[model samples]
Target: MNENAESLSRRLIRNFNTAPTTHDVREPLYDSIGARLAPGTAAQKLGASIDTVAPGKMSCPYHFHYAQEEMFIILEGSGTLRVAGEMLPLRSGDVVFIPPGPEYPHQIVNTSDQPLKYLSVSTREQPEVCEYPDSGKFLAMASAGGERVFDVVQRRSNDLDYWDGEP
Candidate 1:
């Protein structure tokens, strides 16, 4: 097969079960496999991924985005959607919409004995800021050319004055 033939065949089509894994987190509280699906296609303004979280784990901390909105489509198993200090039960076929801002800080907790799988979609907003309430930290990230150029995480208590470095 020609080089272009193989590339074109897989560019626009993908199965979540067989998608290429982009990230696998096995931290103490986080255990998940993220399969990025949008990067394989021509999508520029949106991002999509399928994440499978192991039982009794979560994919990320309770955080809220400042610029990008997100949606989650539960595909298999059951979990708990922890949002804004509330614990909401989640099951297969559940659709969740999270708007940007601290008012909707959220995280997925796999409360089931089986792996919880969901399709996560979000706006590809640059120079995004995410605040983690539980950790008292925040993340600032920026990307260019489909690559991350800047990513920083700092605690809220360590913030500097606007003119700290100014003459």
Candidate 2:
């Protein structure tokens, strides 16, 4: 391994709560927060984050990925998993797996009075495309240094001709 990789290695993260919370004020009712844990460690193949959602809030919109796969390990509290129009209860120690496909748009909603916490893990594939099944919107993304350099959201009808502007 390289010197930087060696120096960045991490064996333990004692407290997930110490990571602090983050959310968008515009999202109000749908707000959730997370701490990215693996990116700082220079993890190459996979990425991880510890997410927490307040009661009655959702973690995200119902969407499915085109290239990336994701899994979540519930650490505490209770919630509901909504996938492809199906609703399922979730609790501590639950493991949720989501593979690449248009048929599995998913989201999490905190149902109990307490905060729901989970560790989200996903494949680190770039140039990912995602679709929101319910909203008829799509997302195109390209990442560099763990930040999205190109992120676009559009409707299916916005697609342009492939030969447009071509000589």
Candidate 3:
């Protein structure tokens, strides 16, 4: 294997050992969602896993990838899928796919009273830029300084573009 691949594998194992297996509360976007990322697994590029969310919680913010494609297969409970511009109901045994594009800002929200469980799979090497259209937030991965951030609105001074004068 290549050096980078070997290094990533080692890092993944280390992260799995050190990272918390489960979080008690939901993350940045969800109200009551919690996740348990499987250790030593790479879901984004190499495919990592095992996500659980509580009722009224969201799997993620409404966002779309630039290069990565993601798939979610429901294992339990029910939820609502906000994809493209529509909200569709989802339940156990349901499968949803989000392809790379700005047209689909996808997210899952649990409306049922029980916990929601699912397995998410994706390719490891994809460079992705995600945008939350409703919130006007954008995040770009694979950048040198880590995640790049942007706002979706025009600035007060129309004379300059968004990234033209920033540090």
How many residue pairs clash per model? 0, 0, 8
Error of 1 at 35 (Å): 1.1
Give the C-alpha miss distance for residue 40 in model 3, angstroms: 3.8
Model 3 lDDT tens row, 1-167: 99998988765653323445555554655754333353344433445555677777876667777777788899888988988889999999998887778877888888788988777776543345666687766665552222323324332334466699689
After superposing candidate 1 on the true structure, give the runs of residues whose Cα lies further than 4 Å from its correct spot: 1-10
lDDT of 2 by residue, 1-167 (tens): 68755564453332466765576333666867888776456467788888889888887888999999999999999999998899999999999999988878899989889999899999978989999987899999999987779999999988899999899
**Candidate 3 segments whose C-alpha is farther than 4 A from its true place:** 1-20, 24-44, 143-167
Span of ten consecutive residues with least summed lDDT in model 1: 19-28
In the range 1-167, model 1's lDDT, one tens digit per residue, is 79888787777677788877856676778889888888757678999999999999999889999999999999999999999999999999999999999899999999999999999999999989999998899999999888899999999899889999899
Candidates 1 and 3 compared by TM-score, better number: 1
Q: In terms of TM-score, which candidate is strongest? A: 1
TM-score per prediction, in order, is 0.90, 0.86, 0.66
**Candidate ordering by lDDT (highest first):** 1, 2, 3
C-alpha lDDT (0 to 100) for residue 99 of candidate 2: 96
Q: Residue 38, candidate 2: how far off, in angstroms? A: 2.2
| RMSD of candidates 1 onward, in order | 2.1, 3.3, 6.2
